[model samples]
Target: MPLRFPIRPEGLTSGPTLRPSGGPNGAPTYEMWKRRIGASLARRDEWKESVIRFFVELRGERVITWGAEEMQQYFDFWVNILYSNAKILLGHIYFQDPKLIVKKTTDRVIELAPMIEALAQYYQRELKIKRTNQKALINGIITNLGVTKTGYKAIFGEPIEAVDERDEDSIAVTERSLRQMGLLKDEKKGVLDPEKYHELIADERPFVINVSPFDMLFPVGSKEMDELQWVGQEITTFLSTVKNNPLYPKELTENLQGTHIVEMPEGRRMLGIDRDAFAGDEEYKIIRIYEIYDMKNNQFHIIEPTVRDFLHSSANPYEVLDGHPYDFFQPCISPGKDVYGTPLPKIDEAVRLEYVTIRQRIMAHIDKFVARLAVRSDGLDEATLRQAKQGDLGSIIITTDDPNKVFSGMPNPGIDPATFIHLNQLLNDLRISTGISEAKRSGEGRRKTKGEAVLIEKGSDVALSVDQDKVDDFVTGQARRLVQVILRFVDYPIALMFADPGQAEQERAVIPSEDIRAEVHFSVKVGSSQQPNPELDRILKTDLFSLAINPATREALGFQGKAPDYVRMFEDVVAAHNLPNPEDYLVDLPPPEQELEEGEEGGQEPANILQALAGGQQ
Candidate 1:
């Protein structure tokens, strides 16, 4: 019998059940969604496959190869337009360096910077392991834009406490062998030191991991911000080997006679449940688990037959990871909207056409070059004629008395001038379609003037700005969700160590309590946002410093205003330059001799101006 998951009793009409008795495959909800997903993917399979093929080509993974049987073969050449375009896009609009901000304003809140730093460290460490850092994020964004037309960066907490027995055993054997050889000191009970032993084991840090778009399946006709009414994945699992493992649900074990099951040594393997649920040494049978998430009517249902198998004897599995809006598997789309975004390759058909045309021209050029050397066949023997077909001999064998009558004149074909022009035009078309100009790709040519360079850069930025904005929004949302996950899940104290803006080593203790987490909000600041243009930064810093002492632009810049927060501005500039903390050098300045402006109540000038004057006098 076909795999069937009954969702309704014969008497029931409709309540919260997914499907009634005559529903799809007798599994009204799951089977229906499965068919929808399969159908939708079938429609997009060609496009998706094309995008993947193009990306692999650009990466040099898929090369065009021809055997000796081929009459003529063209050398595979990819201007790698997609690669260059993605690099530019990432260089400009990738993930911002995240900084956690406490929304509550209190003296005690300032103490939260260390905790915020720790949270940032946690994200960086986790993202790095999962290859979702700034650079990787850019790659994902560009790939999705160029291929899939949508990108995803999922944030889910996973246990980092699992210890690999193989690693542990290897370490133990090494230590024993070293002890026997007397290579290590025997001062303690064991040759291996406690610190060294600890170093070999994985830490107990809970971290988040990313799920690739290829690995994820969503409902058909889904939008980014829309409520994911139904989402699911098929996980693989094993059945228990015990005579009758009470934990194994009868529905799963009995109905696992489906053709899609895999047999294993210890037990049979099936799809839908977690493979890691049992150890290799453990006797178990494999089973599939349909991890379905139904969020209709504000109720999230994690329906699975094996739920009872993995649940604690006294507690339910749902109690552990109950559904929450924050925990919903979210999708982040780039250049996306109410409808799916158009892929870069699809949007630029000219590039594909031009690329194909250029490849043909190159093959023609190669054919012409090969045909340049002609073999005169007038007096050539049978063997000689065969050899001529294989290669160029430079000279022909001739035995005829009248060579001129027997042999015809060899014709030399002139090169096609129009081919070069057409090739160049095609290349230009590729550049226009991708918006990756030669200047950005750094192609060899005449060096551009500063004004020309600026113009080219401006044009590239204009083409990319819309996409960048979309990416920015996506990145910001991901960062915020990650922050929320950290806040909700991570409740331990951490001694986070990081370098301050001044490149000095600094350590801070962070104990994130529910109260602190609740009061905090996250905002992603582009790593280079503060210094959009380095030249502008230098000019502004110099002007601000000069005006600090001259009293000319000081009032205008708010140095003398009621909001005498010049210290904060100075600190920002100092941080940008990686200078030492300003608090250590700060000193209160006596009242200025000049009269104060109306509505300005400050009696003391900032220490920056006094320090500037003192340094000048010295």
Candidate 2:
């Protein structure tokens, strides 16, 4: 039911009845509104009332029913509504005030009152207690003259009653003793060094500027504070367990591996590469794999249970320095080019100095830290390396996520498809930039790789050359072998679609009368605007043309799982030709899928594929 507002009579006689005389409405102001409510109340007995007229009954609730269940539900509904409404009513009472109240109690006057009181108290304390109580007051005559006599003795070498009784003693010099002494030199300056004293200060007082908000300074007090017999007097029982509590750790001692700044002044800065910050650098990547070398055989045999962890930052490379992203004006990894027209030193000179200093420091502390870590690089097993290589990304720790949080400000078609297309274009550009390979082959009896054995019509736009017929014949043979391996793992789309967990439905408030997740199966035809190339089509018809490729290698190999592994190997080699050290970190080569055992039951199609995914890669 809608909350009906009662009519208030002006000028406060305060006795308006349901049928009062001389009202805004002829039937009486309250009476007419009550009648409208009565009509809504009477509609419960009728059957032909329109949905609009019976909205309060149908959409909300009507309290006409007297049954126990109906009565409870109505009461609950009203209570729920009033609980929200009561807060809003109280909010107005707390926040609102009459114009007279606002004008009388202004914030400007209220805020000034305490400050005025403080200033008055300060003046009273400074002026009221002076040398006025001279009628045998111990402090007024005794201590005052004693302090004066001591000061006179200190300056003139004479007692209080000595011959300097007529000498004009300036109160300015005596009162300015704090400023005259070295104690106040920091506030006034020139008492220490007239030329080189630090001008830096808080308001020219020669102090450190712009200190950290967290930094606090306190004077070391005497044992007097300990003498106080307060109830909660803290005992000084604390002891520091860390050896290098402030200055140096045993790990960074000279006997250990110690680091130093390669240079004194880093040109503009005093310090060098900050080791603490360097440890946080996201780009510091490590390859982890376990292998043990045999001194006799001179070969590294990977430990039985071995794995490789490739660490990468989800963040961009240059984002390691907070707020300072590295900019590549003209993107080229080439060593000696114009560097995209910007003249760069052999390395950034600033960074070089910093890095050198960092290396020094790390070496200084290396012996102790490395000694404790139990890491033996010479004896590093594949398993240990692999474990170390994996970036330690802990499980996601989102504690206070709101399941029902909604952002209403997103624009239509919220995320544009152009972004995805742009990203794809960028990857493709870098794909071609490094290197593109084209096989060269003539007639017959050519030297080539084994996998590159395939031959097709020359100069055909769609046909791909497997290898050169001119050189080593290993290319063609390798290409053919690679084709056979791919043919075995060629995957057709699974008949069943993997469920999308993101499609979990929300909880509806009302008991759902219908199921929305019921599958409505449908089929659609996909058509490409361009037609297939005839020569390529013919090539695909061969028994060797089925493409089964691992998804990860396909990305690194720049193929849509179509190109054979032998072809990809050639491409990778050609692309990485310009790299300074190409063999250091190459992508792992996955073995071809093998057939399942003879009597393993419940073996589904793509069992080799599924097993290749799960039974683990060779």
Candidate 3:
């Protein structure tokens, strides 16, 4: 039976009753949330399927359905331009080392910048953020949307077993040992070892996870994620995993049943899971867990609707940025006005279909042009015709007096070169539509001069800058969320490397929980992750060297023509070229007063700037 909603006389419609006609309830039953999730999924099933198809096309898999077998065979040749285009796009967006800039709003938190930036670097390293961003960018390019969930995770170590006080020998030894290790807080109040009692033995840190668009769900008609009433994530895991997870109740997990929904096959197939493998296996059953965050009610829930059970429910545990921990990246701007606007994919459906059509036509043309034999049966005998048809080498054909009538080669039609020209034009169109130029894709430009090539590269960069800006915004948002997690949940002090200005080596610094202030701003350095332009590097080097070598230019630029100034300029040139270990080439120059004293004592000449520059260059 189809579900129906209630329509009022005023011409307004309300969804079906969440609870049964007359069921007692403190909160909406698991069935109600399940239905809500179902409605949200129903609203976006078609859209999600389209995104999935885009991914399928990106993988170079066949997506054409209801086609003739012969035609399908001919269409087997997929030019797979999408794959190459996506690869080039990903390379341009993937950041090697993301430079996160931090600023504090209040003067009181001014000292926290170094610690916070260091912590950001720590999270980037531990979480493998560069790799994560690459994955998200790939998904974003394919589906037009990318998502990341950020939160703090605290993992505690194994607990120490309780020792009975009646066994004085055992109690005494345990208490004394714990006291020596500084784990004991009280002896008489039954709380002997605080570490064992509090279960604070393990690591706690922030985490970021790349979320698939299919796994995420928002309320119907939600234009923006922030304005949504609720959001949910569908997690599929083994039954044992849920049972062993400390967050979910073990009793509920043990009694819960695995999901057997027929509607989930598409999603499962996309994730590369075989449905039949664990269908009826009780021990290895797969559980579908829905983690829903109710922003309006400030509640979080973990439920297994297959069993109609709520495994866990509570107020929002993470009160970080926006009181939720999700950041979204859309590579292309949505064409619609709504927040849930349909994003324009880099390799859209129309482009893929057109490419396949053109390539298949070219294939068909070639197939039709293949040489075939045609002989006159009236002039040639059946055996001779068969032998001629076989066309075997060294087999002489005994033909009639009019050999031309008996055997003749069929005239083959020439394939028009225009067909290939059209195909090439189609390929160029694909690149242009995706904002990828031939030079960017091939990593070479047609320009003869370096300046012209640089100009072309710059033009390509401008075309891709929009997507790059979106990625930067996504990363900046995630960084802010991580900082919030650090401020609110990081209880212990962590040691991290702090990059001090004017210092050759990074210094180790420890940041305690109190030092992480909540009021801070975050942003990524624009284009910090982009591939370096050799022309720009050359220009910078030229300018710096000219300044170092020309005394007049330095004096004009307010640089005191001195040995130390020349050394600084040389270091700047090395840095501009991205050469490692600037310190290795530098010499420890004496202070001017010391140099003067030495000159007076030994009547030595002042340090020569030109020699110092030359030696450093060598």
Candidate 4:
């Protein structure tokens, strides 16, 4: 029988209902609506499990049920295999050098990366209580690129406008604090309340919390026409408190009338009482809170099934950083239906399978080593024959004097070296097929010239560039979405602390996220300064130097007849080469001393440096 919803008042059925309350004759029941969503999620989760089974190995209970039993044994080995490339690909493509560029009027407004860095630090500081941002980001990126999908939800406190407003209680406390601090000497004497003091003095700046992929689920099979303005995701998390939990929210334990209970309404109503099941001597059981996203209307229903007042938050404050929070960053999209972009591990599954097969074959070679024994028991006692046949006891004495007839070495087929060659070939194919063969084998190959090596590396990245571009698009979208959230939610001016672009000291710039006049936007630029094109720089430098040395080419190119102009031209070359300050390296020599004495006004501008050099050569 289908699980039923709890009894609720008829009045509660006017809005969205938890049960199939009275409605139009043809209206689908609440249970039916849930089933539709559940069915789609179940179908999508099957695909997720298939990918996870073959490639992705997650800790704890998997989100989806395993399809095949045989693959479970391979999880450990495949995790190792999958992680090696996943780590490299995620690192090389995006995190190797992540740059955030904010634009205003087609010009970079300020250093956006520092703001992101600060946000990342804030996330670590607030949520983790200790620093583990890198670990968190690494896991998130790997899951995004190699598993099913990835999402980042930014959790913010109440907007400044909301938090700054003080009620009558706050005003009275502030007045008391003023008197306690001796600022109001003539006012009525009163002691300051510690709770109020702490509340008033606490930092209330907006911050972020990073959500792991494993903790979240969204509509992977959603269509474009769904017009889903908000995410329809389900996030599961813990709400821990002490025994009888005075610290836990009272609203959490008080049973609410119209809420889904542990997915069904049959469970206990009181959350606190239900949690007694997890209660031990003194430890409190953590209550599981399910934050389900309602698709039609962009909001979350915070459901704590056991709680009497199951309502946590009808509307979620946090928003997904990427527009399509459900879709994942897929590096290598397979040829099949792109409902969910195929994970990198799935794309390389065939190669990985071959690798395992070869490994098993090599291990099976041990079975070929066989031994043979021939016994001539013409006069041997039954005990001796039995002992020889048993192959037990250290020494078996032959009844007859001829022992060579009883014991002999058997013909053994030794392992072939060709098997090792085949193993190596398989590994090579695995690496090449996945597009990391050159990068992984950089140390093993014959030494290549710098140019050749660069070309090789560039070519190797070509295979990954497609996936890299996809990641870039996702990241860019995330940046844009984050900005939108900040603008819509944050009313206070935020001080973005950043490293000074010109100096070593730290600097700060304030951004007002709620400003209507603000026309700022941002895009994430990855692998620009981090992965420099040295070959391009070298070529440009050589070409410019060649142009500088040849006076004929300079004249034909409409050269401004001055050495200082040539200096400016060289500066352009250096700038294009992405070097900082050409003046530091390229010092201008005093104009031949004679030109300095003659005051460099006439005399053909002291023959220009290149012209003088060319004249001497002539």
Candidate 5:
């Protein structure tokens, strides 16, 4: 059933109510919005609790309790298997450099492809996107859902020099220019060097914030991200940071009250911390801020629910031409039709509980059957029995004349082999359920040839392709949103540094806002950034060498009587070997002189293909 809140008339009421009525004149008050947010959070409590429990399992916490008399040893299969699998996926997903393919949608903007690609690559490095991607993927794998919020953020510092408004001839710096420069302070008064300004605040750029699943809230009936009417995030921050921020009005910040025990709506509880630690520390008092993105009303708001006040409220400030600034990643789709459907975590609590139960029982059984000595009461005294129980290597035991009648070793209570068989089957079931095979994890397979290894690797890749494709789609969506932000806000001609083809050193070019104005499509070259498979590289090298040696094959492939393109072949070989910058190792050769007629004077025979291949003098 859908969780719904009651709708009240637009007027202040005196009695307690489930829903909030607006203030005077029908303007929505902060309290009104707070009720709405509270309802949304209450609806998502179950899923949020599950996410927290999954995190506990990932950390190998004690989820299953035991009695005082029971053995309490936990074998952490959750972290042992799930974390290792997550790392394996991360290695394959981000080992190679990502290649962002930007193409012009129309012929008129065809020249902008290189500039767009360079800008995208610059953002990729400046934003540390690969790190963000790794973090998000790991979170998604562990918790079933990962989210990222992308938008342009500009931070402004105090003005260096205020120019007179009447000075038209003077180089008057506008607010926009100051924001573009992102200047912190003026080292020298009245001097503005673009290079120095850029160096001053190089860290200020667009942001991609990773939002945890616990802090996110959406409606119960929405099936997809875009279909949601609103989304809210519960943020925990210090009181001083909120007061110092420029976006919030001073009226709201000054009147705010700080509290040390603010209840987080995300079901997060603070435990084992002394409240006296924050007794007199008002500057660092922790607080909760609720940020809501209301798509239905096209409004954005930041509220302090503890004090029942709105910090900042305005129309949506972002130019969401592609979509909202949020991107979601799920390893696999949920089985139900609603957004609240439960996604399968990499490892759940039930499986871990079952494994631990069986293993602990086996250990307890073994404990009951430890080696013992069967000595007759008449055969030995108490002291002798104690000595025998010690089972010392070189100790004498006083006994009667008939030593054989005195003592006998207890028969061994051998464990049932089926117990081990059951354990093995459980492990096998786990591997199959997670789709992480033993060979894939341990890299141990009974293969006699490199070809078989390559085939196995290929099969593993195919098995993981479904999850990989989902991550790729999420990344592509983020790239599109990032491009939109760049086009809208990058109004100044910023200097971009990139490597030019056939050049030994890097080059710099200034891209004006006009250059970035183009309709471009964004895509990620899937698997291009993945780690190189050595077996696959060996196969590729074999094929390239065969093509180079077989003259008939070369002729049939239109190489005719000329040597193949050695430069391209060299680059491929370098890439196969996982070497960087193949261009640096290549030498430019002059074009072959046109063949002269029989009577012409300056004519030379073509170099032999074999001699060229061997780099030998003819």
Candidate 6:
């Protein structure tokens, strides 16, 4: 009675026919014998060897794609037979579902990320989710959330009833998550808006930075450069045009010729030089002027701003370039501006290697500097850096987080809560009541104890033009708030003068305790080879992975070969009830979701079309 799909209809007979023996069509006895032999094999060993496979991806044990779970499981089992541990190493790549809208796809994936994360951990060591993954996750959640809703509740029941529904609220989280997945194309606004900040996440590989070596050295100066800064700004614009920004042109010129850039009223004195020009100098008077830029030893090929400036106009830059293109002009490790507009010296191979070596030393020290900031000593667990406020300086970390939502977010500029109103009332009273106020003879407070120092309302003092009356009013008002006290006589006591003052405020500098450490990783070049330097390569493969670094260490040693295009600051995590930095308060409204359109077109109701179709059918 066992069922098999591939069997022919005629062969399922009581006794299979070899050729219908004795019937109009064939010989029954021989047919029966051969059919019995065929059926008796059950299945050939070779047939059993080739097994069919099925896989299952369950969301809380509810199948997202119907029958996919069984297929996945079967495939995993068969694959294992051919190769051991195949399931444990598999990774999945999700794409946008052909049937789902881009918005819906994003919403679904974010919802399912936690679920997918658990599954990835169970089946494989790695996990990933593409924008496309959203659709699949959404579909899975829809399928799972529906069927297992009751079961999941029962399993996680009783004392958990008070939990709030975080997932259902904040529908804008879908759009934010989509953007993180690299799918949303809304170009009008920057992505940092807090309503858009509620959702985000990722996975990664590799580490590198642009800190170049010492041979391609640039001189350091304390003063900030004006022209250099401007040139840097222009160069940054130029680099933006070059997709990945590939050059590092330091302001290096071997033999320099600099024409002074004009600034108004030249500090160096010239008896009668033209407005735009200055002749020589008594220049040793220290006018704070400086040449803030210089080139790496042999890095530039100083040529005319035009083609005529080259040493040999017709020669190739490579043949005339001293070293290979990559080394002659290695990408700049540190950002700089050309201090002198003159042609730079061409660098050779020897210099490039040395440059890499010394730059590595500078980078190494930076690592030590960052380590100094992280608080680690003895066996005490590391605590969050609780920075203390100092002087007029406040302790606030720059963040993208929504302030209104924060526990200590600044008081709302829009609404005055009761505490703030009460504080404001107290402050106004202090501002008006200075010393004594007898003028306030009919207000809420007017009485004072017998020897209380009170400033009475007196008319303006002549000649001096001082508002003695107003001053008296303020002073007398203040006396009502103060306790009456007698002071020992002074040489020139102007009848009951008040003198005790409040304590002076202490002051301090800001050196705050930072939870995050600045870090640097060393990168060295072995001459000009395409191969990774053996020392650096070894560090990446061995040191980076094996080292059990804390979060601060990971942040510090982010990369040495490259810098980040977008650095997500730890302080930037935030959320809001509405899109954009709300000009007013955030009202907790329902999230943005697409609702059922009731037979719509372009998301509007489509009643006419339905009516027309019905009429046509009739």
RMSD of 1: 18.8
Model 4, 1-618: lDDT tens digits are: 112233346565322233333324433334433544465457556755765654434322233343346455443334344354555554454353345565544223343444544553443334441222233334433443222222222222332223235565555543443332222223232322432332242322333234544444334333221233234344433333322333235655533223222331235444443443433422222344544544333334544445543243333333323323333344444533323445555555576667777676655654443333344556666886677656543223343466554443433246577877887887777677766645434433222355664565566567667656666665554444445444444444555545455754334555544343244454555543124555555665657776776868666666555442566777777776678988887855534433344545543443466767443222
Tell how far residue 277 is off in model 1, in angstroms.
23
Quick one: best TM-score, which candidate?
5
Worst 10 residues of 2 by lDDT: 144-153
- What TM-score does model 5 achieve against the real structure? 0.63
lDDT, candidate 5, 508-539, per-residue tens: 55555664443667777744543446656656
RMSD of 2: 44.0
- Give candidate 3 misplaced runs (Cα > 4 Å): 1-29, 55-83, 160-198, 245-251, 259-283, 336-348, 370-426, 491-518, 526-618
Candidate 6 per-residue lDDT over residues 1-618, each given as its tens digit: 111112235535322212223522331233332332233223322222222211121221222343534553443232223121111111111212111111113444444333322322221112221232222222221111000000000011122121133343333443433333223434464533433333322222211111111111111211112211100000112211222211112232222233333343745345465564432222211111111111111122222121122211111111211111111111111222221111111112234334434445444554543222211222223233343111122322222245333223221222236644555454344323221222222221222321221222121012112222222222222111111100000011111112123423222211112211111111111121111223333333333333424455556657544333221221111111123443233333444446557776443333686544343222
Q: Candidate 3: what lDDT?
A: 0.61
Candidate 4: misplaced stretches above 4 Å? 1-52, 55-81, 93-97, 105-203, 206-208, 220-252, 255-283, 306-310, 313-328, 335-341, 366-428, 439-451, 493-520, 526-618
Instruction: Please give the range of 10 consecutive residues that has the lowest summed lDDT in model 4.
Output: 146-155
Model 1 TM-score (2 dp): 0.47
Ranking by lDDT: 3, 5, 4, 1, 2, 6
Q: How well is each residue in 19-131 modelled by candidate 3, as lDDT tens digits?
A: 23222323455677888888777766766655444444544534434244433343222223245556676555656678787866776456667777877877888899877
The weakest ten consecutive residues by lDDT in model 3 span 13-22
Off by over 4 Å in 1: 1-85, 92-114, 126-130, 133-206, 223-227, 234-289, 298-342, 369-419, 443-448, 457-464, 490-521, 526-618
Better model by TM-score: candidate 1 vs candidate 4: 4
Clashing pairs in 4: 254-308, 254-309, 255-308, 255-309, 256-308, 256-309, 271-306, 271-307
Q: Model 5 off-target regions past 4 Å?
A: 1-29, 43-45, 55-81, 160-204, 261-280, 319-323, 336-343, 346-364, 370-426, 492-518, 526-618
TM-score of 2: 0.11
lDDT of each candidate versus the true structure: 0.43, 0.25, 0.61, 0.45, 0.60, 0.24
Candidate 6, 602: how far from true, in Å? Answer: 99
Candidate 4: give its CA RMSD in angstroms: 15.8
